[model samples]
Target chain A: MDYVLELQDVSKTYGHGRTAVKANDRVNLQIQPGEIVLIMGPSGSGKTTLLSMAGLLLSTSSGIICVLGEQIDHASASHRAHMRLKTLGFVFQSYNLMESLTAIENVELVMNMAGVRGSRAKERARELLAMLGLGERLDHKPADLSGGEKQRVAIARALANDPPLILADEPTGNLDSKTGQEVMELLCCGLGRDQGRSIVIVTHDHRLRSIADRVLWLEDGQLSETDGNYLPEMT
Target chain B: MFKLAWRNLLHERARLIISVGGVALAVMLILLMAGIFAGSEEHAVAYIKRQPADLWLMQDGVENLHMSSSLLPPQVVEDVRGIAGVYQAVGLLYSTGAVDLGETEVYSYIFAVEKGAPFGGPWDLMEGAGSPGIDEVILDSDLAARYGLGLGDTVDLLGKQLRIAGLSEGTFGIATSITFVNKQTLAGLMGVPPDAASYVLIRPESDADRVQVADRLKEAIPEANLMTREAFVASDQEMIRQMGADVIRAMNSVAYVVGLLVIALTVYTATVERAREYGVLKAIGADTALLMRVVAAQAFISSGFGFLVGIPLAYGIGALITTLLPEMLIVIEPDNLLGQVPVLLAITAAASLLPLGRIIRLDPMTVFKG
Candidate 1:
């Protein structure tokens, strides 16, 4: 139970026989609680495929995936969703807050899905958004918020249910440099790590390595640790 | 979330209005068509439904008064009155023909009641006497007004000229206008003895058991069919509905189809518009049941609001019709409203299926694309 997420030799392949392409070839990774693991990879390196498998958003062709001591590789879709709601949270790159919902409501949605509703959920969502500097923008929809504000709302939503693990896919890809750095700092250093939550970030941003506890690189559907010798790339 | 579905509908205010409006109009159409049929049936059986008859005695095998010929001898009325528990019995002669109003001939049902009978038919008058005198007839006030005819004005009934002795109320419609005349005139016209009668209506004594009295009357007059008031009213309504209920049913089916299309199209388009949001929800721990709930909630919101709005609109239109066309009545009974609730719910449920399937099959991974 020390590791919040564990993936053992996970493999995913699209199609079969004559026209098979392996997206992840027996990838193995483990993320411990309160750890910031940054996944940097080239496009089509199957980084997203690996992240999706870890997040329980996609099924692995062959592997043992466990989240919070529960083996969910073969769980029913509903069960996996339940696991995701209770044990994991996600932050998308585009800040995919529902257009119809306000900033506070976007954050409250995950908690509501976990059956934490009414005023308790509302107060938690409010505290999360306020911590992320979205107190004044609580009533603003996705359309009204700036990119950085939207990403903060996404982070607030990701932490709304107080899940132990957070999976962020290019959380700052839509923001400018200063704004992106602030969002990353607020997500990984401010609220996430301080609250004993593990964070997994999949991105092409090399500058994000400074805050990460471990920076790993994905290439050709395989994972490898990037030492100081790794070259920096433009996001 | 249901709140999410509701907000999604509310976000597009114009589409929401159009969607709910479409459903409301369809519901109104169906209810109005049904109300019209019910109103017509009520009008056709006005005499039977309005009268306080405990039992009806007609010629053997004549089950209804509308479009039925029942020739009971006048002695049957006296025989029914003589039965224990029988308070009073009145006889009537019925015929169907057009009334010659000099300028225009209006199709009507002509009934001949006894001149001094207190318990005969819907003998209520709006402006004139309650019963017709010798060589006199009682016509609907609306019909008399339409032709510039009034009390003491003459109308030709079966080629016999008779004065309009009284003008009756609620006896006119698009069809089935009633004209009441004295039994002596009708008997003389049909070349039958004045004592002959077509049907007999009986009122049971206040403290008597109607079933026992009806049995005794039936035994005494085997040549006549005996029916309680409820059976008689139902039979008349059945005959009246046969004339137009099929058209009403067909119209109602079309309206329901319109409602289905409106709800389905709006929900389908709304789902497609929010496909990415739905994908986000799916990726973030929303199960198929939750997605289905959102879709179903949207459909029910549209249909439930539409139905709630339709009832008042139907009543408003009914009032407008009553004012503009006094002879036409629109009867939207509580039973009618209660009956349509299941139909609307079923339509809403059916409307949700397409969008539900669309979202259930959506891959949450698609939200990762951009």
Candidate 2:
């Protein structure tokens, strides 16, 4: 089966020469359609770096990076942006919604950027926000929304264009335990369905493991598979 | 996308006001400078414009009335009238000098209009008659009001104390004041023949092509210069414009710079403040072009609002200036106001460039850092 995302011998190095630090050293990973992959690691373990590379937000020093079965390691900046908009979505740790825009507008903005406009974009935004249980808070700005609500809005935005892959980095870092569980369940769906959407979440929270189809362990710039219940020592 | 840019601008009321107000001040400065130049242009040509003559005749080689010297022989007026297209012609004695009103002396263009002759006199009068007696002067009523003088008040001209018997309207300007005296009175003081005019005002016959009439008069009086009214007014206006061209250009430059800086600084600051949000947008897959377009749209809206608000403010100040200082005319011409649109647009684009670069180089990866 064609994987939704693939990484082969991808490496990212900061600086050069003697001072160079390898963030992701020859990392390889693959994710299939409708798969939910959770990447858990200690501080500075290169989880964000791996996620950044997969999301096309950062360039890899060497190796192949593919999204939706298309090689994109050498894509132009403009082309990279187009791929991100059309084939991938991102949920940042900070909830990263445009604070100036209302919840519905925040969702509509991504659609508008993707050639969706006017009433069509508006209707899609309303449906997404309503699906995220933010139907009554469409006009609320980011500042006015609660932590869970903001994350929900960010999720709605991530799902706005219904891209095949979603890359989230610590999406529940700022949320309470119960709300974070509820939000992650809504993400993988409490209804137990992904609708053919793949999600790659990087987080330190172990509670998210229940909602993920596969929980992957990332340590020292390398990714490894693990049994669902295992937790590494904090060191 | 445009809505996002607008929302960002409207997010903070205080910042919005400062941004819009800064642009408004710049627009006001640009418009006021242009209005003054246009206003003074009219004032400079007021003398010729107010006359009803279709053509002007003067001494050979003399071009305009202001800063010019012309003395046509007395027979030149008759010679110009003898041409077929010339319906009527009147001789005028003109001089540029100071008119002493007791403790105040006003620089003035003193014209001697022949009694009861058509044209070459005050076109509008506030009081008294268009024709002045030997010992009487027709002066601007606004000038008279400014100095606590009225009709029958005494003003000293050419060392002779004369009464202000006629009050003309629209004769006072920043350049000089125009006052009319009897042709015989000024001729004696000027030591010239009463018939030897500084310039001759000519009227073309009904149904006559003014260009042909001017050509015929020029041919008939080869020793004197003959010009159609349009050319004569343009010539004088050009001379006056050249006089202040350097100063006006410098002022316009300063105003434009101020406007440019105002827009640039505010837009730059706003963009910088919102850089994080911009990075977020980029991270979420917004293209560089769409983001840059947002920045540009915000800048245009800011400057557009300023343009709309500044015009009315300029007009109000112009009216106030006219009421307070009657000698200075501040004319707000539509052409002058509309001309700044392109320059303001250029300024808006230039101002957005700094922010555009910031957006262009912004790393979308930064948004991923917890």
lDDT of 1 by residue, A13-47 (tens): 98999798898888888999899999888888898
Instruction: Report the Cα lDDT for candidate 2.
Output: 0.86
Q: Alpha-carbon error at A185 in model 2, in Å?
A: 0.5
TM-score of 1: 0.90
In model 1, the runs with Cα more than 4 Å from the true position are A16-19, A232-235, B77-88, B100-106, B119-122, B127-137, B147-166, B188-191, B203-220, B238-247
lDDT by residue (B238-257, candidate 2, tens digit) is 88788988998899889888
TM-score of each: 0.90, 0.94
Instruction: Give the candidate number with the greatest DockQ.
Output: 2
The DockQ-derived docking category for candidate 2 is: medium
Clashes of each: 0, 0
- Least lDDT summed over 10 consecutive residues: which range in candidate 1 chain B? B116-125
Fnat of each prediction, in sequence: 0.64, 0.75
Task: List the candidate 2 regions with Cα displacement exceeding 4 Å.
Answer: A190-193, B81-85, B102-104, B156-161, B205-216
- State how far residue A169 of model 1 sits from its true place (Å): 1.2
Question: Candidate 1, residues B126-196: lDDT per residue as tens digits?
Answer: 88777777899899998898889999889998899999888988998766698888889888887777778
